[model samples]
Target chain A: MTRLLLPQIGVEPPERCDAARNRRLLLDAAALLVSERGVDAVTMDAVACKAGVGKGTVFRRFGSRSGLMLALLDHSERELQQAFMFGPPPLGPGADPVERLIAYGRARIATVEVEGEVRRAAENSPGTRFSAPARAVSVTHVVSLLREAGVEGDHELLACSLLAPLEATLVLHEIRDLGMSTERLEAAWEDLVRRVTRA
Target chain B: MTRLLLPQIGVEPPERCDAARNRRLLLDAAALLVSERGVDAVTMDAVACKAGVGKGTVFRRFGSRSGLMLALLDHSERELQQAFMFGPPPLGPGADPVERLIAYGRARIATVEVEGEVRRAAENSPGTRFSAPARAVSVTHVVSLLREAGVEGDHELLACSLLAPLEATLVLHEIRDLGMSTERLEAAWEDLVRRVTRA
Candidate 1:
């Protein structure tokens, strides 16, 4: 069977093993560059050199710098998505809607706290903050949960409201400017999710 | 009593009646231009033409286009702040935390829904979005309400989470792209507030 290519939307899976290996190398290099230098300083050439690959290969894999950032974000977000989608009971499928929403928030907080840098890098990209596929998926997940929780009226909008708390900029502002603790954030989130989900 | 100008932060309130009237005229003209041609298109000269005032008068009232937009946003935001702080009950002072939160959300939603274009214009300005006195006041108001509701743990962060849902961009996205009804938005907000404020 012939495989199809959708370069613009980036929907195609890995084409070859070497390409996959190179992609992994690029991501690892990109992460290191991001740690060493900020998002602005991490160039495709630097990533290519760090990964011991041609700059052309890097471009082929990621298309552009924004594409690379999105790819990195997608990788981490996919792990998070998997954790909430199918990995365990409370966050996944076994628990009730209220419990699941709570679990989802906790998981999200943990994810943001851990992957703060990556999340910030992705957001720093201009004009693409709300267009990430992972963001859409997360919103859809929350909306579905709100529906399951019996909250009537615009479940999607309500889901957007739920996701509001997890905004990367707001989260950063809270921890950095407001001196908020993870425990405090988690507790407030618990309250918020409970109230939003209650009958 | 002596009036001292606070450098880089506060300005002295102007005293000339005609200046104030012309400023109002300029602001009204700017608002109409914003409603018609958007904030970006409303030039000082255009404002003067629309307000039936001279271009120099427009310049005198507002130093630049940025100044004009700031003045317009400041005027509208002040009214909103006044309404929430001292206008009536529920949204003001007489109601419980839960009711107040609901009222506040609904009011904010309505405001954003109505004045979205102006709000978006104000927010798009560089270096002004976060520092605007109105934004700061709104944050303080929400924080106070969260504390009043006995929302424990990082009340500031909790307030931010609550405020995040009312973001102009998110509200526009929900209503425009998501095709949500205002009624449904209000209902979802009510549900969210009830869930968030339960003891």
Candidate 2:
């Protein structure tokens, strides 16, 4: 026998657990809205309805539409972060470093295809561009991969040079303004990865 | 005989030439201010005094401070465009494609070191990002160089990826937040150029 004293020491507060679940529920609904109807259709009322919660719950969780969009972006980016860090195979682990780099860029381009508007909104600042925690994680991952692949020279800057093309702001522009396909972007990313990692 | 008739047919207007010279003079003063004390030090009053003109002249040429910054950015970018398009050797025409590409990135980094703030202001919107005439010219130049170097891939997108790191927004962040020197950036750029252009 095992005795459970976790609840007594506040291991799980019911109210907080409920709040977290509730917040995730709302975000899931918002993500669905983005995928189904696009980012422009993700109004507060629409999100509330999609989540089957009252409008007050939506407003309480996110102060405004932009706030909701930002939260949604954060959620989506975290999902991507998890995919690369811990998921499986080429994007995660158990793959060649060069292949992983290619997969990572492909995944980033896919994310931009979905959540680009939200990502671009946040990347508007030149000063804060590289300071985001997500960006740091991505850079660290790329640098480590470069080391694993036996590529020489300045890894940090090389990571940045590689990551620059995958940025949502630039990706969105390439797709919308320049009329480029994400397929083409992915192929180009692979070419870049191979070129940079070549012995 | 032909020149005598040309003046009567509205050729080389005196007022327009004076206006063009005045605009150039004010822009020159603003560029000097930028080089000496940075972009923040450039102001209507400073430019007016630096150009030995009245404040009203500066105001008449550029409607506001933001307007002045825009014009200054345009002026500087045009100068760069001219250098790469028609000027001698390395960056322009005579050098090998790979060498020209390296010089172009280095020159762009140098320009960003000086005119970065102004350039970043214009790149704020993702929609208009690749639509700028200067950006188009740069892309065309890079694509031509890639083709000339016989690099096999999507030339347009490869050019875009090559050019992404040279953007003022990313360059400024790498310098300011990441504490990277421009010299290091230039060297890394050369490495990337060689990698992409390798046979």
Candidate 3:
């Protein structure tokens, strides 16, 4: 529960349970709406109606449509980050660097494949998603794996480079505009991971 | 000798020799001005004066500053493409697939390092540069190497994935905003290429 930061001000936490429930409902409704009609059609009133919450609740939960989109993106990214960091053997702690790297990339590809539209909407919005904590988490995870693999290079740059292939814009471009298949994308990731983790 | 396309129009043949020479002069002057005072400070009349060409010649050669900037980007990308395609081994056609892939990444990093400002300007411009012949050429080269390496993935997607690391915006962000060293970038590229082309 990170406090929402505002210019020259910070909000206190200990949010009411009801208010938190309403927020969750609003986000769920918004995600449903986006899946049904894309980001453009997911209005505040519509979300409120879908969630059985008041319009004010929707607005309070996320100040605007862009804010709502950001919240959803943050939520999705956080869950994915947690899974990669602590959940399983291959993607988390116990696996070898090569296997973990492959697991990580495949996991990322699956995340993007599931949340691709929301991710694209967030990216097309003005700011902040790329610099978010989730992105930092992913970079740190990749760098750690690179070190474990004995990659004798700038691990930080290598991490960024590894993540570059997963950029929303490029992924969307490949899937939507270029008629590329997700199977192909997955295979490419496997190839990339193999090449990168080779001794 | 590729035809340059005007906005909303089909491509046209190369401009006459004299026009090309004048365009070159204007571009050189504009580059100098931009280096000294940034892209915003360079002007048509200033470029004309610096190049010892008439203002009308500058206008005729480049239509406007935006057009001139695009021409310069196209020019640089073309030269780099030519060098990699025909000039020498490693970066050129004479090297093995794995070596060529490494060279391509290194060459692209060097290109972004040298003409970085120009690449950034092009990146910030509206519309995608995917359709550019330079991009097409690079894609073709990468696809050829992927084939040569017997990589079992969609050649198009894999080539793009490999190229994702070399994107101008990402590269510039890493170097300029993150205070990353060029050595770090080159090393990362080497690591990436080795990973991408490994058997």
Candidate 4:
């Protein structure tokens, strides 16, 4: 008996699969360049060379240097989001809300250490600073955590207050301009969270 | 006895007085134009026209539009500094530290409603954002207030966190982009101050 074949629902086409892999490869190479050298070193030609792809492929994927930087920011933000949303322990679901809040601040500060330049570029643009989707998700998460901790009074505004210091622009200034250590920033954040959450 | 003395120390020469008065007049005109018509309407020609001075006088006083904006910001910030440092209670001395802190935030938010465009422009410049002398003074004031309130643990960083949300760029975003009422922001700030100071 002959059987009819059909495309699987909710599945990516083979071309899309190749496209995804290609995008991932370029981003991974860019990330490596940023880590090893710096954000300035992650040029399109460098990413293409590192990814073993043609320069045209890199350009086609990311469009421009800024486009690549934005995608890199989105990629790193998504990873952090996943960890805090689904991964185990303090940043995720298992721990108390206050602890989770502390973890969130720590995680955000850590991101500044790595992705700061890109984040600062995005922040310097007035249009993207507060309106980025990732920022909205972060605000929502902080508000929920504040509610979970039983803190009252304008949780949304409070979340904005809490997140403002962790912004890349400010954190980077503290770290780079003022010579503040990341550990000190993290400890201060923990202290802040505790104080705000104290009953 | 006739005081045949070296020019009285710290006294302006008559010609210098004229120059100072001219500068103040130009600045006041620019400020009035900004308030009545918004920042974009406060051109050099307009300031000259408003002040009843020659356009050359405005140009000679400020050099350029950016220089005028910076001077305007400096003028406004100094006024704020004076108010909080010595002007009256609630915002100045004689009030409780927490009340002063709350007043500080309210004053800053109010400034955003007026001088936000100019302040945001200054903030977007990397050199000016954190390193401005005015910011340093403001930070020192907040840190002292926190200490006076006996809130412990990283008072400097905590002050920064508290001040972050009151940044003109962020406050303007909340007021203009998100359409959040200034009253709501003020109430939320009061809530934040109480939470941080509650022991």
Candidate 5:
């Protein structure tokens, strides 16, 4: 058996173990920079300084500023996917489906500031936004969760409706344009989940 | 007082009576053609023929194919907003809030094919989608209706979630890419509205 690939939404491309670890460090540093000071702060020098590495190493790993952002987005998305798919309860398989749905929205919202710009970049290209392998996985997960929660009526579309508010694009607007907080958004997600799943 | 202009979302730029009527005729013909044969069939000559006007009139009314599509989208959006805000019963001012929401969603679903493309076109410019005056009007209307319906929890965010499934970008994907029917989407919208608003 060999490793699987889900590359359109980007599964980890194979690399040497040390190289992969190094890249993850840089991405983590970049993500932190973005979260702390916004996407504009993700310069090569800043990411290098934060990661305790030379600028040359950062450039060698990602080629340019854009390359670094793309890598960071890819890394973040894959991490979220892994967390809910294979990690522990609530977001993973062990908890009630309703709780898992709530957890999934909360986790996705937490990533909006870091991952939103690139996701918006992809959204600029019309056909690519909805067709990504990652989005498909998310939709399937939510639909299955809705079924498990015993929610009735058009589970697939309802899942889409539930997932829509958690989208990076919409959440970023609510936060940046409307001055909403992450805490408020998370609480709203919980309320929405309960409303949809309640008997 | 002069008529207030919501031009960014196009609350109708000032126009002479005959020109406005002529424009409406061309737009309606184009709308019908697209609904019958899809957006690809919306060429100037075809629109001109459908509306029983000379081709020069079509070109004069809307400079090009893309221009015509944009106007059609604008016209359609305004009509929906008017219908819900001031037109009549279920979709307008007089009906129950829950019934009004269902009507609103059904009305929006009816316009997906023609309007979805231009809406997707605007969405390519990230800031424009959420910030448009027309979208703002729609959001305000939904929030008010939710409040009127006596629903609980995060009315603004919940309204966004309810409206998200009705977005053209997403609905077009369901119809064109996922092979879903319009009737199904409309019914799903009704189901979703009920779930969110149930006592």
Candidate 6:
């Protein structure tokens, strides 16, 4: 999917260069807080303290904790999207479709390990779970790769099937509630990809 | 997968045979309301009126609207479970494992078409989604079938991947929002099963 064609979220006006930089700084601080102490530790005050900015600045930039959380998730999703769409193999342009698909699954599993709480929060609302533009983009990418790999079936539904196990909600349950390790999850995903893509 | 070993839901005291009969009557009324109108139309008053019982009887039996919805879902799940585990061929004992798995997916899609709202409501709650005993039983059944089909490598996760597309929430969205037909979804699912189980 083209970046220019992607849907814009939220109704915020365009930011000046410095304002955009400041927003990134606050989101980075919030992400660091999430990584260091979990999602609950990302209170406005904590993010403000972590970013060395006033609490008022944090609120002014993101509006609320949930807003900040959403922004952080969007930022992370865009980064992954860019890596797969443009960055080097095997997750990007240079590798075979099957290898790229495997890399995509691994990258998604890794992302969930870090941003699971945030992703689950976003998904908790029923309407947003499958309808999010980011989700659509991911599905489109997967479908493209499946077609490129010459799999002769319904690629759209096949992509959905492949992407389902990588969902944050299920992945988090498998890891936190079922106590499966990240490496094990990734290996299982790789196996699934091979099974589907093999002749 | 045995009915006797299945986890029972709710904690009401055992009902006398007559009370059990009354409860079945009430549930049948509720199911009819759901089918004829929609899930939203299955109010307590409507169920009581449909069943030719007092409104108090509906409340006494189900406690609340959500309670009635859960019971209806449980009733439906039990029926499907029985059919797959003990009833006729393809879905039950006397068919090839691959055909049984395909039958299971087709049956689940048909159920969701009828009971999507109730199933989505039950699945919306995070704590209940993956942890429900009914879900566990379904997953175990799929895993067992995959092993029976002689598919190698992470049968448990593969079963999860297969079942994810059949989830009510996602299936509902595909049918309603995306305008995909149930026939199309079932065909795609059959294709998916064949791909995963193909030698």
Per-candidate RMSD, Å: 5.5, 7.2, 5.4, 7.7, 4.7, 2.6
Predicted candidate 5 versus true structure: per-residue lDDT over A22-136, tens digit per residue: 9889988988887788777889999999999999999999999978876776677778878877789888778888899999999988878777766666665676678767787
Q: With candidate 6 superimposed using the best TM-score fit, by how many Å does residue B48's alpha carbon deviate from the native? A: 2.3
User: In candidate 6, which residue ranges exceed 4 Å CA deviation?
Assistant: A1-14, B1-14
lDDT of each: 0.71, 0.82, 0.72, 0.84, 0.82, 0.85
Q: Could you give the CAPRI-style class of model 5?
A: medium
**lDDT of model number 1:** 0.71
Worst 10 residues of 5 chain B by lDDT: B1-10
Q: Candidate 4, residue B33: CA error in Å? A: 2.8
Clashing pairs in 3: A195-B195, A196-B195
How much is the lDDT of residue A78 in candidate 2? 78
As for candidate 4, its clashing pairs are none
Give residue A192's lDDT in candidate 2 (0 to 100).
89
- TM-score-based ranking, best first? 6, 4, 2, 1, 5, 3
- Which residue pairs does candidate 2 place in steric collision? none
Model 2 residue B61 lDDT? 86
Off by over 4 Å in 5: A1-14, A36-70, B1-14, B29-70
Per-model TM-score of chain B? 0.82, 0.86, 0.84, 0.89, 0.81, 0.91
Taken in order, the candidates have interface RMSDs of: 3.0, 1.2, 2.7, 0.9, 1.1, 1.1
lDDT of 6 at B67: 91
Q: In candidate 1 chain A, what residue range of length 10 has the lowest lDDT sum?
A: A1-10
lDDT of candidate 3 over A1-199, digit per residue (tens): 0111111111239669987777777878887887777767788888989989788877877898878877888777766666665668687677888788888877767766557778866544324435555666777778878787887767888788888888776786777778877777877887777767677
TM-score of each: 0.83, 0.89, 0.83, 0.90, 0.83, 0.92
lDDT of 3 by residue, B17-71 (tens): 9876776777778877766776666688888888887888888777988788777
Candidate 1's docking class is: acceptable
Best by lDDT: 6
Residue A55 of model 6, lDDT score:
98
